[model samples]
Target chain A: MADIILNPYYMQIASFILINIILGISIYITLSTGLLSLGSAGFMSIGAYTSALVTMKLGFPMPLGIVSGAMVAALAGILVGIPTLRLSGVYLAIATLGFGEVIRVWFNNLEITRGALGIPGIPQMGREITGSLREFGITPDMLGLRANQFSALILFFILLILVILTVWFFVRLQRSRIGRAYAAIKADEEAAEAMGINTTYYKVLAFAQGALVAGFAGALYAHTTSFINPGDFSYHRAVEILIFAVFGGSEVIWGPIFGAAFLTLMPEVLRGLADYRFMIYGVLLIVMMAFRPQGIIDYQVLDWLKKKVKRNKSASPLDKQKGGDA
Target chain B: MKKWMKVVGLIVSVMLLLSVVACGSQGTSGEGGEQSGETESGEKVAKIGVISYLTGDGAAYGEAITSGFEMARDELNEKHKGELKIELVIEDSAGKRDQALNAAQKLINSDNVLAILGPTLSSEMFVVGPEANAAGVPIMGTSNTAKGIPEIGDYVFRNSIPESLAIPAALKKAVDEFGIQKVAIIYGSDDDFTVSGYEVMKKAAEDLGLEILTTEEYATGDTDFSAQLTNIQAAEPDAILASSLYKEGGLIVDQARKMGLDVPFVGGNGFNSPQFINQAGEAANNLVVASPWFPERDDAQVKEFVAKFEEKYGKQPDQFAAQAYDALYIMAQAILDAGTVTDRDAVRDALANIKDFDGVTGDFSFDEIGDPVMEPVVLIVKDGKFVEFK
Candidate 1:
């Protein structure tokens, strides 16, 4: 198990899982607020292209590229959300889907994005982290590692930190007033509106937030993979992000994260199956849906776990008495 | 609830066990072959990674590549007579970039393959090439032909002739023989291969002093070319030049012919597949394409390769298969020249130093940038098949 965990191939898979988790969370934010937006991939493309151009063409630092990418995607989200948020349900999904297609086509024909040849050899973020570490008098050779290996380790920790911070932000949002407004909007929009809530404002806000997260993920993805293309943000990719959210149970913040991680790792684990892996993946999804329609990690499971923990805490004194008797 | 949970847990455990057993069986089978080869040779087995799109949109090309690699593998083993056994660890990318990356990583880190062949598409090569190069693993692209591919790194190489070399050959033929003064150009704007092919064709046409009367663009997988064809027909160019894969190129030919535009259609390497002729049927006639391989070539190596490939795969080998076959042989010859399979740098150096490798494809040699320096043939579709044009 230690060997498997330490394998560089597995480490790469873990990085992919982390990236997908970020993408899943990006979509989950909007889904939680009663909006089924299919624009995450578009936002991701915007972010990826923006950051890639910034770093590659403008010679900006990677950090600045990411911030600018996220900001641009947020601005695009607002522009798209203002009009589309008026529609509800499938209508809104179709609009966003169209928006995603538009972005894909626009990038496909654009001159700066290289017209489908894709921009390659973007600078690696690992080098930046290692450079900073070197300034602190911590050299990679001191730890008996190559520079790239040390870079990868630093990258993994950076992703870990990002994941924790994003999850914490989501948790805080879930307990806040805006989160309640979103829940109310999801539960009964008409009622929420009757109770003096501005449904459109909250919905657009949710969309912009999702776009910001997706853009941030995309910026990181461009730097990590060191390549960006229009095909990477097609409608199929949007559907994949949606699947991650839906399959994981979008009711909770962690559901999409779990879904993305499990799905990302599942194919790698089933590599032995060869050509049958995808077929088996489809079958497993069907079986999972049949058995647990809510998702692999639904709200009910969380509630059950919470109740079990409470029960265990309350039974500790009685368990001590029982231990004395034994 | 508890009963359901237990049932789910049991099923999950069974699946996990099955997968574990599957992996064990696979490993043992591979080791079994290696052991026999090693006992006879008294030398360590050389493992090579072959990544291709075995399923999905690009499966046809992938399957052909795999067949070519397998043929090369079997022939090399027989020739060496166990003196230098080669084992191929093939992985399917399913025509997706992420899958290609995963397969490349697994090949480099876990399987410890000496060299990697193919991620099939230019776009995929863009992603996996850098990763492999970074890891110091040599990769030979069997069919990647876009610009700047060989420039990825020193570790990257490709046997397939890029459009830059192939396009001018075919275009010059069309211009000289037919006195083609003006032509219509159509290409898939979304694809790297087609887009690059278009760029090459545009440059070649301009250099040849041939006027480009019209230019049309379509996305891949679009079956309808009436709008583009109609627009082209109005221009009344002497011939049509298309830069696309077999699927879309065939559609364009059929649609162009149906619209009564019977001019000769010139294409690039993407039309070298038999499927293009099969798809367009009678309309496939008069379609000229530049290719690095022609299976019907009256050469001893070509005849033997075609016979073996057809006998094994029960189909005529295309250019993709031909290039892949040569790629495997090139790698094998390089390893033999280097005289070491375990040292990746030695193998890479030997590959870079390879010259005058006569194979099914014309004489193969890598230039300084690791791009192949080989002659491309001009082929025209005649009576539902590709034949060498005089």
Candidate 2:
């Protein structure tokens, strides 16, 4: 067991986590706006292929390649989003699905995306035994630290900062007037439209933000995996991200975290289960939805937790009468 | 419940159950996708179907090999008159087992091919090979490298050596030639090809008394290898025996080099492609691989075949193409020998008794399990070309 834990495969599991965390955070951004535009996977494929092409063909510096990949993907997201913001719910899902499929087919046909041959030989980032800053002579011992501990530390913290930034923005959005506008859109768009909130603009912003995160994740994934194919970023993967958002409760800041953790570990935990693993996954999804329709902990539960102290033990008749009247 | 609603609900449940069953068995790409489309068959021609993963993850390999096979079919059709006309129908497996199996059924039942060329995944081969065999059709797996596949049925045939034969000798050759001691075995944990090859390598490595210093596993979709390379670097193995297909193999070698893990990397049959070279850049120049086909062989027959293939495709054919070329020749031989395509049983029996039929992959002969009994080619990637080594 110890040997397995220290195996390089474990490092790969961490790699999976790094990419998923980026995606989870990306999905988290859209969930915050109360608008699940559901099209980030398209952007992910765009970024992945872009980084793969640049890195493999142009030989750009790893960091530059990743950033450019993300930038290109975000641009694509903006382009796709401009035409898709008018649809709501099922219509939005269908359009986004079309976008995903279009990217898939385009990648399948484009000579540049290698048209399914897939781009290989991407330069890997982060070190296994040594941290990057150590190359500049700031060894862990020199900085009073253990060696090899922080060489790839920046990548993780980069992901952490992304998550933190997204959460902070989300919480801020939840409290702001515009955030309230998003909530109104989520709860009832018709009333929000009557109230003068520009639903289209907010929805477009939400889609753009979500797509941006997916692109960032995609770029990071390209650098980390050092290889990618059209198969990696498919419509099924978009659903995986949605599953992550929903599984994490979709209400609290840590919802994506919960979802990412579960999905990431679920496959590993079920490694012993072999072919039965996917069946179990489907079953788990059904069980979770049946028991916890709003997810394990959503906004309502958190609000309840906050107002738990010093409340009247029972509803007074006047309060009850007021509640009943309402 | 209302009658129609209850009927609809039952239909939905049955659909789900049927899909689950289909997926579990690894045949048919769901219901009515292609099976219904196979309505006509040419009785005069010997029709063969290639259920290949032509446009997805393994697309490069599939496309490359099929190019060679397709070329052979064109040339064969030109040569043969009314006796044994060979026709190949290209269908995309999309790397799905059910799809491949469904393709096999369609080819056999509707297209009524005397033989089928593929179902590339070992699991898919497991699913479809038996049925093809039972129906008296010989299945020539162009690139199913996983061992024990021929056991699916007696009528199944593949043009490549199984892992048992390939892995042990390949390792012995590496150990003898490279003088390697410790080895780092890296493979994809998800796919049966890599996993099966890894298991064989594990035993062969142990039996050879080589130390398994670091065994790293990565999922099929994982692209990052820094941490794993780091750990392998720390272990400082003399060689890295990677059981990966082209894309991952390219990334593994590239990353291992970037991390300064400068050991020579050895790959399985998956490395026998031009795409790997294109992907691995200069780093692929010195990579060693154990393959089943050598495009640059000096054999008289080989030279002629290579000349014909290159002339037709306008590019050098990879191992997959060579293997598929051999597989098609094998079918052609059986068909010509049997003297009729309508007697599927005779065709299957003729293929079963095949012996010493010199083809591109090598002397073709089928073991009792219907697998090609052949030797693995020793290859070293040199300056954007595959050079055959002793």
Candidate 3:
């Protein structure tokens, strides 16, 4: 099992799945606050170019580049979120959609980012981080890993940590005062503002948080793929990111993770279908939506499952047997 | 709840079915490899993976490339007879970078191919090239004409003429033939191919001591070129140099003609297609471009290949098909020369050492950096057909 999972083929797929899960959760953050911003792709591009350029030109280490990428994206998110957050629903979506195009065109024309030519040969996180560790007299062989396996293993762990951290952050945020403010704003923006809840502050905060997560995901994505052009982040990508949250059920943190993992793996699993691969994938998504309009793991399903488990534990022996039979 | 259960069951069943298919394919491939080995017929089989846009917007190019490979495969197997056999593993990238990367990874790791042929576009190359190079597999680009492709790694190779070579050759011919003193430039700025081609055209025009009047840019999917054509007309240059794909390149030429800006229009490799003439119609006349493949060339080999291709595909072969045919033949020759079907390192060396190999595209060889070193022929559109420019 370890060998199968650690092989280069599965490793590549695993990395992509993890990156997509991060993107899924990133959009989920904004969706939870009821803000339909189509700017995740823009924030992702920001993080990608920022880290790529800094690491390549300024000699920043991979970790630093990743952080700076997320930070810069958060800053842009704040700048974009402040003015655009006032517009609700589809209007905000359009504004953010335009923002995405503007960023794409900006990178296309910029000389430093190499326009549409893209920056290739960016250092992979696994090899670069492992090489630096070797300089400090630690070696991958000591951990029973080959050179290639060592790099892939390191990248896998880094992404795993980021995934865990994002999930934990959301879990905590959902229980806090800001989370309630977000819920309130999402439930009714005018009412929340009437109640003096500082709706704009919480909305902007949610947007920036979403941007930060997306930016970090993008930074890692660029390093793993080792190439990025302006075309990589387009309007289609923005919509795809939103689909992750929508498909997975935006109400819970696990929804986006499940959604991202399923969707990302579906294409690879369907590879044998050749020309019909994407067609089948689209059909599957349609089927999933048709079957579960509120998504597979929405609040009602969870509540029902919880009640059923409780009843199973407390019922009489005869009732328990009947329940089991049913 | 029942719907959810049904959906879950469906997902699980589909996954199981697909896994069985994947395993079944792998099993057959293994059996085939062993069967080839066991046969005392002295026949060798080489697996070469092909990644191209078999669907989506770039499907036209992909279809042409696929047909070219199929034709070359049929001819090579028959010609080589008992000595060699090439088994191609074709994967569609759908003209996307991630999909291209996934295709390359699958080809390199799952299929265990000795080499890879293409991912079509240069943008796809930028992503797939590094992956193939790192895996130590030789990948040759059939249609990636962007700059800095070969620079990705020693393992990367391209037979397609880069715009840097084609654009300069076309401009020089235009300068000598038309005696043009000045030129205006227009290109699609959103694409890597056209942008690089534009950069090459600008430098080439300046190098030939021609004055550039004005430059205009448009996005790739844009159909209206009147705004940019009007700007070019206002500049009043002797000729208009354009670096764009056939879609926009044709429209720009057509728009320029309608706007009464008639001078010889010199274009990069993008304008070397029959589709360009189809798009521009009568306006296509006097349009000049450089190409490595010319079906109308007075060569017996070229004529035979073109005739055979038309018979097979029931359509005229374009430059893309010609290049792809040449690329596969080049791969087969290298595999035969190395005398080892599975040893990739030996095959890579043989491919690099390919010298004076004649193909439908003309005599071809790889320079020090794995870029094609061949003279491109200058052709002008005349009466909706390409003819050798004097």
Candidate 4:
């Protein structure tokens, strides 16, 4: 178990899965509210560059860098969301898609970002912490960590905690007043406004929260990869985030998580396919969608399963009562 | 319920099918391992990983690179029979940074390759280089020519001459031949390679005391160049200096010629390809470019390599193939010189100390920074073919 946990390759993949889950859920938040904003990658880039610059150029700690990164992305979200959230469905997707391209070009033109050359050698997260731990005579090898695994393990734990926190927040938000407002707005914006739901405010709020979560994922990604460039966050990536939500079934929180993990791992598992892996991946997605258009874990399926279990429990008691009467 | 069960059954069956396919490949790989193990009992095996864009925009370059390396491996293995063997584990990066990073990790941690070659593009290199450096594995790039590549770490090395070196040579040749007093610059600003190449050309032109005309920038994949070309034509410089990939570079030249602003074009390394000539058609004539590999060179090694590559691949090897061929030789020679195939530090040291090594790419050596120090040959397009510039 220790060996498996400390395996660098698995740890790396797991860390990436966690990050993708965050991205998946981030887009899921907007999807649930009937908003098809394809700007998560833009938000991610803002978070990655901001956090990387904060830590590397400004000499701030990783925590401060992460906070500032998420804050900045959320701020941008509020700013962009307010104006663009008025557009809905495919139009909103196109507008947000343009927003992503603008951010990419903006980073490409900035001197501080070093234009297209990008910022390389950004200090990796957990390096300092590990070093300080070593100074305290608590060496990683004593705990069975191998070369480069120590930092990877540290990153894994941090990502795990963040994923848990995000999931918890998502669950809580679904039951809150904001969540009901989101549902109402998604069902019918006109009706939601008629009910005094302030549809715009709630929509923007969901967008901002999505941005904040995506920002957190980006900051972690920048540090995990230990590098950042504008090309890393493009329109394709935004679409990929959307795919995770859609393919996993956007109706439930578990959908995106399942979708992201399965998709991310599918590539690795498909590696054995050699040259045919990508083709196979595409075919599989097409097949899955054909069969389960609502996603692998559709809300209707979950609801049916819940009702069936309840019925089975009630039927057993009824059968016992019938037997007693006989 | 029946439909739900059917979907579940289908999902499970697809996963099972995939896993079965995966296992079959794994079994084959296992057999390959044993085959190598059975050879010479205790003989050393040098495991090397190649990360290239096997299926994407950069697939052509990746294909050329991997085929070059494969040819080198076969030839080297035959030459060193019973002494040392080489095993290559190739991974496709698909031209993405994260995929390259994953490839690097798999190479370093899982396969434990002694060295790595290529993630193809410079953009991919930026992400993969640091990871290899951190993990204490040497990585060499055959096609990454951007600045600061070698500066990633001591473990990072590249034999591909940067645009900083290649551009100046071409520019100087153009300046002397055309007697140009002023030059216009154009580049794709959104890409790392073109951006770096542009900076080099701009600085080289300034250093040559040429008057700077108008500088135009365009993003990659932009089809229309009328706007940038119009500005350059208005400047009416004696020559045009461009730093862009072949697609955009070719279009710009073709457009400028159509607009009657045809003086001459001195292009960076990106314009050295046959594709550029094909893309620009007759406008490609008199275009100047510099490269370390010249297929038409009369040198015996160059002639032999070109012949063998053509025989094997049924196509003439490009600059990328020649560079990759030499890169593999350099890496293999380093492993041999290190005398311990598994010792990465020793191989890196050996690689760093390589000097005056002759290959198809001309005399090559790594400076202290691990960037190659090699002379580039300046050539001009004449009658739709590259010829040595006078």
Candidate 5:
């Protein structure tokens, strides 16, 4: 296990899985609020191109570039969400998909984005961190590692923190007043509105938050991969993210994370199959849907697991007392 | 509910177990006998990696290229006999950049291949080429012709000629002979290859004192070119220059001809394949293209390669296959010259220093940046075939 973890090849795969998990969670946020906005890839593209340009063109610090990327995407998300959130279900999905295509086409024609040639040679985050550390009196020999040697590890830790914070945020939101309002809107928008909940605001809020998360993921992806192109963020990518959310059980917060990680790792693990990997992957997905259509994890399964743990805890003392009496 | 969950669990576990067994069997059958293949001279076997899109939109190119690699591998093994046996570890990239990166990483780290042959497309190359260069693994691109590919690093090399060299040669020849005074251009704006090709054509056209009437663009996978053709026809230029892949290029030509625009059409490297002619049929009659390889050349090496490739693959080899076939032989020659495939740096230096190496395309040498300096041929479609334009 240590050997596997230490391998740079596996590290690259692990980093990729982390990035996809972030993207999955982005779409999951919107699905949880009952709006299937298929526009995370657009926000991601905005984030990637913005952060890349900020770093490469302006020579800004990496953290600032990433933050600005998320902020810009959030702004764009709200701008799009204000008018489009009125539509529901497939209508909203189609609108968001159109928005995604518009963004890609804009990137393709924009001179600042270098048109279709794409902007290459974006600086990696690992290199910037190491350079700062070295300037602060850390010896290179003491570190005993190259810039990219620790890149995947740094990305892993960053993703770990982001995931933990995101999960915590969603759990807290599920219990808060806004969270209940979102739940009511998702259950029945007209009923929720009659019950004095502002469905429009909450739905739009959900879209904006989802965009924010996706944009942040895109920023990280750009810095990690050191390359960005319009083709990288297309309708196909958006659909893939939706699949991650749906396949993992969007009803629960953990579903999209599991879905993203599992799907991303599946192809890498099946490397031995050569060209037949995708066929086997399709077969497995079909089987999975046939068996557990709701998803691998859902709210009901979580509730059942909670009950099982509680029963075991409550029954332990009773069994102990009976044994003593006997 | 509980029964259903249990059944589902059982099925999932069974499928996973089956796959694990399949992987185990393949590993044992493929690489398990490497130890016993060593000769009395204590020379170890050489392992080379091939990465290409075996099953996707670009799979046709991948199929042809891999076939070429296999043909060359078989011939090398037969020629060398017991001295050195080349073991190929092939991986599929599916024409995606991330998949290509993963394939390259696995090839370099796990398979431990001395060198990698291809990742098929230029977009894939832009992402994985640097990764291989950083890992100190030499990668030779067979079909990557976009600009800045060889500029990826010192460890990167390509046998395919870039549009910068190929486009100018063909454009100059067309203008000088055909007397094309004014020209209109159309290209796939979304793709790096077509975009770069358009850039080269634009510069070359201006350099040759040709008037640029208008320029039009379309996305890849778009079959309808009637609108773009009508717009270009309004310009009424002496000729039309198109920078597109074979499929769309053919459609553009057919549509333009059907619209009664009877001017000559000059194309970039993307139309080099015979598929362009096959798809456009008689409409491709006057279409001229710039390419690095023409199988009909009267050369012994070219004849043998064309015959062997046709015999093996049951189809005429395109420029993509020709380059791939040449790439494998070049790698073999470099290894033989270096006398050790285990030393990657030695092989890279030897590969860079190759001079006047004869290939099916042309006799070329690697420049300082590891790009091939080969002459691009001007070919025209006549009588449903590609022949020298002259």
Candidate 6:
């Protein structure tokens, strides 16, 4: 029990932190644009299997395999997004959810994807393809640090930084012309379109960007877990991510991130209520929706805090002037 | 306050309290030997944790595993009169890795189970393994057959076979003993069980210097294999090894015969279900697989168990059932050997020390890792039932 909080075995779940974080941020990206996409899990599977296959079959380097996996997922995202650009709100969610299922079933039936009996010993990049290369007769240097603790944490922060950077870019985008176009489109698509804004192009870009994050996250996920199967990317998972987005608050950049972390840790927190965990989860979700629809905190709090600080600083100057005049 | 808000607050508080109680399974009964918690010393009363995929895709197989464990508990309790007490705490896993982890944790933390059995999928075990190990509890996966030790470090045990041993041995028997050549390989690609089968089968074929006529894949729940059969026939393989779980395996064999591919198909432990032939009807005959335990494996203990299972269930015990019965008995044996119900480390070591502990599956021995050494049964499908073959 003492070691339950941190065990070498926990490295798997911890490594997955990057996956959830990336997924959360990706969902955040879509939520920021006043759109929601539930197809990240599907895109992840595409990336995971594609990356895993290339690494295992072609014996490619780990980085290339992961990148290829992301590229493949991104490509599929664009392909799906091109035709579904006009759809939004629940319709978009449904379309993306269906799209995910179709992709899952396709992977399930495909000869290379291996159907139900998923591929085993999936050549987890760190597990098989390492610096040692003993099997390849090219022992450059073994990834001799036995436990993947450092790498797992490192990968997590690296992904966290990427999410931060993406958000920073999103912040910039929200202030830019394209960002204005998106805001206008979100406020009213027809009104923005009347003003000559290309809603379809911006919407497509939003879908593609969301998918790129999902794909990149998926690649990282494949390498970290070293295994992937059709089961991992079921439609239910996509819905779960959507829940994360909605629960955390759809309108904020950090909403999805919080949602992902909250849900991931929720099971553990609710461990005492073992039998009724899911029931409680449902009730809690309804409660949150009915009450705190804006989430635990919103971005306006930041602005309020910023203004309060500025007011105090400016008040100091006025006080000094008043004292000198007296 | 809004009536809904109060209701929500009450619900949240109750949920929090329940969780606290659940995690309280870690509560030790002090030096009193747990006498305070029971109804009475003479009254039969003990709690056991049963973790499984009771509600997900693995539910069908997981149900069998739990029932098997329950069956053993019933027998033990009834046989010992009221002196031996037992209660089963059954938890459903959604088959997600995280769900498995939570279920297992709740079982250990809240239920105060002496030991847990199941979580039939390898992926679940991979995720839940560490927590069980950290908590110093024993978790036995009755049906997962993936390679390598569980992610829970080393405290976990599985009464299953890995592909590295089972697949090659079965294929060799097909080629060398049966004099079969030019085999076709059809398996599920998306599952680790089936995909591992492909890699092992391919390697074994290449090593044995046997030629593969064609290789094929099937999707889960896809009943038709006529397309794969067409490709198989074109190559003219003498035999086929269709690696899939029971549902699709049965259909593949049935469809193969319907399509006129009469070659004898070898299967893995995935073939060890009575439903396979029952579902396929007469088409199931002549199909063979490397089973974990043979009905006629010449083990008297297994024979006795099967006699009872047959009488009770009105069906022959499949490999999963047999493995389940044996897994519980072996776990109980480890507990008794450890001589203390409270210490998890002692029980784990006692489990590790198991050697030649005979049960239905064969001698239950543990290597450094907690994998049981069970006999591999090669059975041929005959008249919609498995027949043990040399």
TM-score to native of every candidate shown:
0.94, 0.51, 0.93, 0.94, 0.93, 0.71
Please tell me how candidate 2 rates in CAPRI terms. Answer: incorrect
lDDT tens readout by residue for model 4, B1-390: 788878878787988888788878956763464222224566677888999888777789999999999999999889887778888888988887777777787778877788999989888888889778877899999998888899999999999999889989998988898899988999999888888888999899999999989999999999999999999989989999988999998999888889998799999888989899888888998899998889999899999999999999999999989999999999989988988877889999999999999999899999999999999999999988999887
lDDT of 6 at A294: 70
Write model 2 residue lDDT over B1-390, tens digit each, in one string: 255345435544753664465454433322222321122443246777787767556777678778877888877777765444666766665565434544565566545567788876665676567546545677888878776667666677787777777777777877888899999889876555676777788998999999999899886768998888888998989888888878898898888877777777777767766888889887886577777777777789788888877787777777777878888888888887877767778888888888998887777688786877777787777776778767
| Docking verdict class for candidate 1 | medium
Q: What's the TM for chain B in candidate 6?
A: 0.84
Residue range A160-205, candidate 6, lDDT tens digits? 6766776687778778898788778878888989999887888887
iRMS (Å) per candidate = 2.2, 17.9, 2.4, 1.6, 2.3, 6.1
Q: Provide the TM-score, chain A, model 1.
A: 0.92
**lDDT of the structure predicted as candidate 1:** 0.86
Q: Could you give candidate 5's per-residue lDDT for residues A1-326 as a string of tens digits?
A: 85565456777788788889889888987887889899999999999999999998998888899989988999999999999998889999999999999999999999999788887777766556656777998744565654445554566667677767877888898899988887888788899999988788888888898999899989988887777889999999999998898788888878898889889988877777777788878887888788778778887678777998999977899878888899
Fnat of every candidate, listed in order: 0.54, 0.00, 0.45, 0.57, 0.34, 0.25
For residues B53-141, write the lDDT of model 1, one tens digit per residue.
98787788898899889889999888986578888888888887778888898888778789999989988898889878867888999
Report the Cα lDDT for residue B257, model 2.
78
- DockQ of all candidates, in order? 0.54, 0.01, 0.45, 0.57, 0.45, 0.19
Interface RMSD of 4: 1.6
Docking class of 4: medium
**Tens digit of per-residue lDDT, candidate 5, span B278-376:** 899989987888888988898999999888887877888888888888898899888888888688898899899888888788897899999998888
In model 1, which regions exceed 4 Å deviation?
A: A1-6, A127-140, A307-326, B1-41
What is candidate 1's lDDT per residue for A166-208, written digit by digit as tens?
Answer: 8899889989999999999999999999999998899889999
**In model 2, what are the clashing residue pairs, if there are any?**
A131-A151, A224-B224, A225-B223, A225-B224, B28-B98, B28-B102
Instruction: Please tell me which model should have the higher DockQ, number 1 or number 6.
Output: 1
Candidate 5 global lDDT: 0.85
Candidate 5 regions off by >4 Å? Answer: A126-149, A304-326, B33-41
**Model 3 TM-score, 2 decimals:** 0.93
